[model samples]
Target: MTERVLVAYASKNGSTAGIATMIAEALREQGLAAEARAVGEVESVGPYDAVVLGGALYAGRWRREAVRFAWHHEADLTERPVWLFSSGPLDATAREGLIPPVPGVQRLVDRLKARGHVTFGGCLQDGAKGRIARMIVKSGRGGDFRDPEQIRLWARGVARELVKEVATP
Candidate 1:
């Protein structure tokens, strides 16, 4: 059976949501059945054969809703192939190299036995909600840093791994 994957995420602004959409699209291109949904809106992870959970980082932590989703669905997640990602760096650090998951997210990785994880660049633009966000945009520090090709590349890698596992045995 083709793997049905869930690319779930918790994004404050629309950046992280965009990233998740890219991931799901890439997965579909690779021939897997995939869907991206807000972590909060997903009622359960039971229907998915694999999951890619992601959240935007803030103040060295993942969005609270993402963490909550992981814990709430821990049992189901542990039984399947899972991947994790965090998008929050406003700079080029994420694109230049690996930025390890923040402490809290790392804990979730360990607990869930995720197949893999990656850190991706974040985007902050005008009309962002918080005061700091507005300040950053006003100060000319805000712009989209997410690399769509890089994200698609990562998603394809994930699809390959899933294929390999399914073909085993």
Candidate 2:
């Protein structure tokens, strides 16, 4: 049977959502059926053969909804294959040199025993918004630092993993 994958994500400013969409599309291109949905709209995980959870990272944490969704559905998620990703660290310089896992992710790693966790460069725009948003945006950071080729490569790997899971048992 073909594998079914869910790319669920939580986004504050839409960049994370874009990444999720790209991943889903890339997976679909490989003949796997993948759907990109917001965390809130996902009513059940029963239908998916594998789950890919993604969210934006803010202040060293994933958005509350993403974490909450994982917590709420931990049992079901653990029974199957799971992967996690965070969109963050707009500064390319900040990305290099042995960065430690962010706090929320560190906690989640222990809880979910996630198959993998990855961080991709996100965007920070300066304008009228919350104080934190404004501050990060004004810090002279690059906008939309997502690497499409890298993302597609990762998504293809995920697709292969899901296919392997379907072949087993």
- Number of clashes in every candidate structure? 0, 0
Enumerate residue pairs that collide in model 1.
Answer: none
- Residues 1-169 of candidate 2 have per-residue lDDT tens digits of 7788899999988879988999999999988989999999999999988899998988788999999999998988988788888887786632543345587787876688878877877776755246877766677653767777777888999888887767788
lDDT of 2: 0.83
Error of 2 at 71 (Å): 0.3
Which regions of candidate 1 deviate over 4 angstroms? none
lDDT tens readout by residue for model 1, 29-100: 988999999998899999999999999988889999999999999999999999999998888888898888
Q: Local error of candidate 2 at 45, Å? A: 0.8
lDDT for 115 (candidate 2)? 85
User: What are the lDDT scores of the predictions, listed in order?
Assistant: 0.94, 0.83
